[model samples]
Target: MSFQDWEITFEERTEELVEDYGDSWRLKFDDNIEPDNPAQDWFQYIRGAFARFQCSKCKKTWPSRRVLVVFHFRLDGRKRKGTVEARRFRQECRRCQEAKMEEPQFDSDNIEVLLEKLVERIRMRCYRETLDGIQRDFRPVGRSEGPHESSHCEACLKGVCRKAE
Candidate 1:
């Protein structure tokens, strides 16, 4: 399938999976199954995730309209690893970007920090086909995955910022 179509499907699957599972696998199914000769599905799947950005200056939120990318590298003590990034996302308010460039120290306007959070959200959203593929082809037991439960801190939910600053 084409990559764009893959993203929508991936997003749906990730949302569905996360509702039940609470997180994506650190290494996706195909990543684990065929590590030595890994399939390119991980790249295909991650390309579909979306990260939205909210302008701290104007408080306007927009879909970053950026595709997430996975970077692979080797560490001295570890096997090959991957991390996601939205490095090219620059669609935010021009004024904000200009302000960031001039100051570069405002916590709220830090592009890297924004991109990091965006990447985190994108990563949380990219595991549908992987899990579905495995379950469809290889679930030996019929047992349910688990209960679907939602948890939240009541204070946080009520918009009360409780942290000491």
Candidate 2:
């Protein structure tokens, strides 16, 4: 919801997607209706970003670049169409005793990087295409020092993140 103010405009995302999936590719904000299950053709991947978080109770703000977001996508080769679903992860305020899992906030730069990596994954997984360069890591342009706080991460708490694994 808060990501509506993303610095990366929709046009930029569309252009990036069009370059890979062609002009018929569509980006939809998934409502997550049915389930997390992906069909046979659907490919699932994880995208991480440096997300900012503000505690509602304590009003404490912090930056974390390891926020894990899940994505499900598929490309219909015959139709030359594609669909993507993004699910943002949340984190709790470590300082607040009754803290709720707050949605992570991302900047334009992070969004741009995330989308680029996502499209790359789509190209490889769905289209079975190989890239010339080495595979890139999800390193967003931001600074968040110290070890990752698994205690505050919703994915870690739910045993879904790599740390939890």
Candidate 3:
């Protein structure tokens, strides 16, 4: 059979693999679930994503309302020590705007600690389902990967994050 007959969908591809291997394909092969295009991994990550959120006071959950949170962390790649800063924008909460002390607050002297918290919030805020459940390793692109053209995104290095400061 010509390859053209195989539909370009995941289910179709999986079926094609199974037919060729007598259902042992799954055991013999690792999952090729990543996006067909490699560039999609990084490009999509730089773009915004979302996740489920539950309101404490209303006792309800909703996925409609969302926020854009821009973030970066600065630290030595080898030592892995640095502070992370994030810009989170959300319209003032109806309940929070009305009451001054309705919400709790805390502070931290250690930047690393705060950065960890920010990263965690981003994970919860960004819906994994929306991003295809793939996490980019953020390693430096090799010569074979793509053009080494000069650009703002050239290096995903630690100091690069500090530039946002």
Q: What would the per-residue lDDT of candidate 3 be over residues 57-150, giving only the tens digit for each residue?
A: 5533322112223444322324422222333222222333242111111112212232333334333343122223333321211122322212
Per-residue lDDT, model 2, residue 116, is 69
Report the C-alpha lDDT of model 2 over 25-140, residue by residue, as the tens digit: 55556535223466677878775667788899999888887787777887777787777777777899888898999888776666766776776687688667786745545444
- Assess candidate 3 and give its lDDT: 0.26
Residue 144 error, candidate 1, Å: 36
lDDT of 1 at 130: 24
lDDT of 1 by residue, 16-133 (tens): 3356545432221111221122244333222212234445677654332222223221112132233232112122334354422111111222222333333344444443222221
- Regions of model 3 farther than 4 Å from truth: 1-47, 76-80, 91-165
Positional deviation of 9 in candidate 2, in angstroms? Answer: 4.8
Model 1 is weakest, by summed lDDT over 10 consecutive residues, at 100-109
Worst 10 residues of 3 by lDDT: 24-33
Q: Which model is ahead, 1 or 3, in terms of TM-score?
A: 1
Worst 10-residue stretch by lDDT in candidate 2? 1-10
Model 3: pairs clashing at backbone N, Cα or C within 3 Å? 50-126, 50-127, 51-127
Best of the candidates, TM-score: 2
What is the TM-score of each predicted model, taking all chains together?
A: 0.25, 0.74, 0.24
Candidate 1 to truth, TM: 0.25
* Pairwise TM-score winner, candidates 1 and 2: 2
